[model samples]
Target: MKYFKYTQYLYLVASILFLISVIVKIINQEEYGLQAIIAVGFAIMFFVRRRFVKKMENNKKNL
Candidate 1:
């Protein structure tokens, strides 16, 4: 369960990589619509998962 604590950061890292790819694509004058969308999705997931994990941890603490 403690390993779950750091797994959320992996989403953040993936989001960052996607964002960087989006930037690179933009610089290269390539289409990045889908990549941009996926990047945003990952960013959103990171926040949502982090919140969910924190809530779960709090619940575990209360148990």
Candidate 2:
């Protein structure tokens, strides 16, 4: 449960990595549409998980 708080950041990190990969692929004149899509997905997941973690923490506090 304690780990859930930090795990959300991993998604952010993965998103960043995917974005970087997209940039690199662009520089090399390669297709990066899929990576770009996945990066956005991960970014969304990061935010969603962050909110969920905050909700969990608040619920714990209320308990």
Candidate 3:
């Protein structure tokens, strides 16, 4: 159901958000737990999206 072409844009947003989160955490130096959780969550999503995109591309090639 997911359109693979949009994954690149999704990653772009996620990466920017992740960078912002890291910067905020570094600047504030507080609540390390929440910041770490968010960072990890985004990282996992990025990998999942990457895999889904790759699968979609392979399927497209076959068809």
Candidate 4:
């Protein structure tokens, strides 16, 4: 499977943003539950993005 280099960069940026948000929430002692939920949301989004990318690659290969 192939991905644009820019897509990989975007993913890396997203991961860093998620990590920073989680750390900031923890350090600030904000609602840990909300923080956890947001983190999970980010994870789910990442998963979906990867799945879609994979599907697109598969379709391209079949064509």
Instruction: Name the top TM-score candidate.
Output: 2
Measured by lDDT, the strongest candidate is 2
The TM-score measured for candidate 2 stands at: 0.94
Instruction: TM-score for candidate 1, please give it.
Output: 0.92
User: For residue 30, what is the lDDT in candidate 2?
Assistant: 99
User: Arrange candidates by TM-score, highest first: which order?
Assistant: 2, 1, 3, 4
Stretches of candidate 3 exceeding 4 Å from the true structure: 1-3, 6-9, 12-29
Residue-level lDDT of model 1, residues 12-59, one tens digit each, is 999999999999999999999999999999899889989989999899
lDDT of 4 by residue, 1-63 (tens): 355523644655666676787788789977566656665666676667777887788888999
Decoy 4 TM-score against native: 0.57
What is the TM-score of each predicted model, taking all chains together? 0.92, 0.94, 0.60, 0.57
Q: Cα deviation of 41 in candidate 3 (Å)?
A: 0.6
What CA root-mean-square deviation does each model show from the true structure? 0.9, 0.7, 2.7, 3.6
